[model samples]
Target: MSLSQQQELRAILEKGLPHAAQPYLLIAQALNTTEAQVLAQIQLWQEDSLIKRFGLVVKHRKLGFKANAMVVWNIADEQVDDVAAQLSSCSEVSLCYRRPRRLPDWPYNLFCMIHGTDREIVTAQIDAMVKKFSLSYVEKDILFSFKAYKQQGARYTKQGI
Candidate 1:
């Protein structure tokens, strides 16, 4: 494949897939190529590890989810894996991950994001998770987002991404 065409395809995909019956055909037409070529190029990119994966970045605020809370927990190192797994399985948790805890000031090592239509809903969900997991005495904190930033996938090109 032409390097310029490959770069163009990458740049186009970074924006998002087109909403159409045959999105690949539309993209192929735009790039003056066949739909099969477009699909094959994407496959090649994936096989070569040029692209890790494709997924949607949901706009929770637009979907009526106004509150997003990142609850950080300081659980025992031995129990962290179990607690994180439990938290990750919860439907309310959008994201759950582990991070190194900073001593003296920051003690939270496990972090999970919970989103809801309102603060109360998110808070209630967090409370339920805490109780369900028996984490009442665990050191933790809830941080709510005050603003919604523009969210998008990775940009391969400097312009039009």
Candidate 2:
């Protein structure tokens, strides 16, 4: 794509695409381009590694998920991948990933987010996961969220790129 097309796409992305059945078609109309053109550009960007990922970000609290917990686990290094795959397969887990352990203070590396309508439900789900994964001996912690915050997509304009 040309520089101008890239800038226009970035501008549209900054404000986020509309939530509709044919959002891309609407975007194409606004950009004075065909849907196929818009989609092709997106695919090209992905193939060139310009765009890593694209997905919807939801406010769990607004959807009745009142209790949110960031569960951190210190799984054995050898089993980290296996355990992470298992955790990622769980329906209760909305997000799961691995990070480097900050030794001397924090040793947890695997992290996952579990959200529910109540604390009890969230706790039960965590308990179930622990049992199912045989994580009784694993060092883990659950940090509950007490406040809801507005979530927004990335803004390329603000990044001074």
Model 2, residue 66: distance off in Å is 1.1
RMSD of 1: 3.0
Q: What lDDT tens digits, residue by residue, belong to model 1 across residues 100-124? A: 9999899989999998999998899
Instruction: Give the Cα-based TM-score of candidate 1 against the true structure.
Output: 0.77
Per-residue accuracy of model 2 over 115-134 as CA lDDT, tens digit each: 89999999999999999989
Off by over 4 Å in 1: 1-8, 30-32, 41-55, 155-161
User: If scored against the real structure, what TM-score would every candidate get?
Assistant: 0.77, 0.79
Residue 145, candidate 2: Cα error in Å is 0.5
